[model samples]
Target: MKDTGLVAMTEFLRHPSMVGSAFPATARMVRHMLAPIDWDNVRTAVEYGPGSGRFTFAMLARMRPDARLLAIETGAEFVEKLRASSDDPRLIVAHGSAEDVGRHLTENSLGYADVILSGLPFSTLKQEDAETIMRVTGSALAPSGIFAAYQMRTAVLSLINRQFVDVRQGYEWWNIPPCHLYWASKLRGEGSYEDQIGGSASA
Candidate 1:
């Protein structure tokens, strides 16, 4: 996570499921996961569980200057690192769960995110916690916006499908365990979102 090389043993020990070749992700996986975003049109972007900011910094590089980035991280170390690592004004690092993405957006004066990327280890997350994060993601994404995530397991695919209509997948074999990637686009009014996700659109 520190570089494009193997992640630190300490991090892998704490985040047991984040290991894939003892490396969180390479630049290859990062590029593949973030390929669908519309950089020109994006006004707000978000990232979930950005351990050492692999994809987070990449998004900052390509996004429009006026765009804002809200990074929701649960790890206190990562939260501090991301905040101290950037003075880009556009970046806002929040030390909290992805379930509160709505509040993060509102507090930052951001509408629905034009795109969101996640590196959370869903394979290790509690069922209720994972469900809450995905449901919140659906409500936080703009119509036609992208929600992308990379995982080492297939379990997250079904969860992501329930929220987005158009789903696409990729595989990054550059790592040992092989990362499974998914990016989905939310529909205009994603199927009675109030009933399914229990939130009104902020955009």
Candidate 2:
């Protein structure tokens, strides 16, 4: 909420190498994809590529007092800003690549998370790196866990859908550039358990 934080966020969003870091998504989009978070089962959440804590704030709002949030970001400046302004005791801001999420969690004793919320630039990632990220993410999920990420189009999602059994689509046309959210959950018996948490079937 500081001026420096806002300025830093703006700079990051405008950077050319990070153009895909469009920083899109309205409050409505945040509410939509993140609303059904199972706070009861979600003892810990691992958020990748949280540039300026937009979705991080939403997650904080929904988490129980005892629950912890681990934010993994590659940018040192962004990580510094987050660690400084993010005063909540439940929040842990780590400076690192999204690909290292598993190691980071393992080092912190948070090996498996109930949910993984990502803001990584899938459209910008190299094909091999993207696949690795997907594989790693899929491997880090708990049996009842869910992975939710937003992309501007379905074209960017083809590789991602290959990993999860139940790949559901959700959208929020209100955001700038709009966005299609991909929700993936580990296969339990048959279908996604999102419905049990009041989540809408991918729309």
Clashing pairs in 1: none
Misplaced by over 4 Å in model 2 are 1-19, 188-193, 196-203
Q: Candidate 2, clashing residue pairs?
A: none
What TM-score does prediction 2 earn?
0.85
Q: So what's the TM-score on candidate 1?
A: 0.84
lDDT of 1 by residue, 94-176 (tens): 98888999999999899898888887878888899889999999999887788888888888998998988877667777655
CA lDDT, every model vs. true structure: 0.75, 0.73
lDDT of 2 by residue, 1-203 (tens): 34544644575566534334445457777777786556666888999877767788889888989888899977666677788877898888988777888898898888688888887768777777788888888888887788888776565477666877666677777677677887777683433445633444232
Which regions of candidate 1 fall more than 4 Å away from where they truly are?
A: 1-8, 17-22, 188-203
